[model samples]
Target: MSQLISIPESYESLNLTHINIAHHPPQSPTATPIVILRLNRPDKNNAFTPQMGESLEQAYRLFHLDARVKVIVLTGAGRMFCAGSDLDIGFDDRVERAGDFRDTGGRVALAMHRCSKPTIAALQGSAVGVGMTMTLPAAIRICHEKSKYGFVFTRRGLTIESCASFFLPRLIGMSKAMALITTGGVYPGLSKYFGELFTEVLAEGTAVLPRALEIAREMAENVSPLASYMSRALMWQGPTSPEGAHLLESKVFHHMAGQSDYKEGVNSFLEKRKANFLCDPYEMSPGDYPWWSEVDIRVGPKASKSKL
Candidate 1:
């Protein structure tokens, strides 16, 4: 019999106060785990400050390193998911120090995109500007039926963040994307027809967190950690020839096979027991998913009330 190598069961404790970050950790331990990150400043309607952005970056980095965190569920603390930037402080002045301001959205988008694990944005209310752009990179998006989504960039005399230039059109179609971006329009049913933006739209006043956690639990329970990681990477890589994808698959397969978790997974399946995978699949390499193609676009009937 081969010797089993044990992995760490918990993360190293650190002082996060120094960074000015706050969070409510997970409540239970399950094979497949979900980490919920809420925007904690509800008094301000969860408006994001520069420091909050830094803190968020730190939190994401921690999640990236922790082997136990598989899926992530992000939401706001109060009525709003995010109201965009805090008008009191200018995010532009901090742009040079914060990296690409024009591509600021893209940078964060890359972080979410590159994460080995899947992410879900549970939007209950308003998600505007940076808030909306951030959700673009998530693997799944669940929004309430009454939830409102807005581009709101042109109205503020700012450009879109992240690689929204590349992502939005792909999800909503070029014509729709153009109108939304240029007009800074808000939409209620846009996510319904544009499946790329959101997978499910629930009833009004539905609680998004519970549903998100439910999904995270399902994914953690049924999917193979190794296979899930590789599949996510493949999807992120987008559409490629079988031969090309196969080459990438070969490397991931060999790497997974050598891990102790792989052996445990196979053994557990045969024994009709749950696999105890110590590492979270979200920490693995990201998959390649398809980008949108340029096609002729059309507009749906305009609503009586203008989405401003």
Candidate 2:
């Protein structure tokens, strides 16, 4: 039961009606903010429908925009994580008006990719199809030791969606990505090929979320929010070359030095205390935080120009 909560002016533009948002307060006396965005369709193991995709995209948008939120933990409710796309609904009807609207999960994936917050995906159970790919955008993935993951697109007679082609190879290498996709097999977190993807695997499903929240709390309480956001943006941008990344890094470094939080960050270390980061991303990031070209992470293929 997610209550309609008030948003800071910076985040007022987006609606939060769809997702279950759990605001977990700081554990220590002065820790930073933490929020959990749970995929709520538990009866079906939180299988994602078109409506869920819309809600997920919107929820991610809200999380990124909210200055008060420092870290985000994305997981499903109950025993399972996500079971992937739901087949029961009629989603094809909108494709005529929307055009090539087949990839609903891609929208949510794109939204998550654009978010600057440090994200943790807590996979309490098996994650199949889009369930597995959707989490690739998140920086950290924590799964239970018993949890299984599948890239079952080929087996299902469906093409891969949610930009897995772009992210999977980068994460596990092209050869591994090809082998796994071709096999259309499900592997546990402990499996050699897929082990690298998980940050850590806990003993049971119940421990996954708690451990993830613990990690989020650690980063939120001690890290500089502005630096985290900017650096995270750079990491995911995938610039053209090493020189391009270097340019982005240097620009962000210079930009951060000018902010007031820089002084506070230094002073807090000297004073032997936790630095209170007041500089929201909306307020402090450089002129071009999203320096990457729009073409890079946008969902769907480039539109073909109609020859008049």
Residue 18 of candidate 1: its Cα lDDT?
15
**Candidate 1 wrong stretches, greater than 4 Å:** 1-32, 92-104, 172-175, 189-193, 238-243, 254-271, 279-308
Off by over 4 Å in 2: 1-18, 26-32, 90-93, 97-99, 296-308
Tens digits of per-residue lDDT, candidate 2, 91-169, equal 4446444554547788888888877677899998889998899999888999988788889989988778899998888
**Local lDDT at 74 for model 1:** 80
TM-score of each: 0.73, 0.85
lDDT of each: 0.66, 0.79
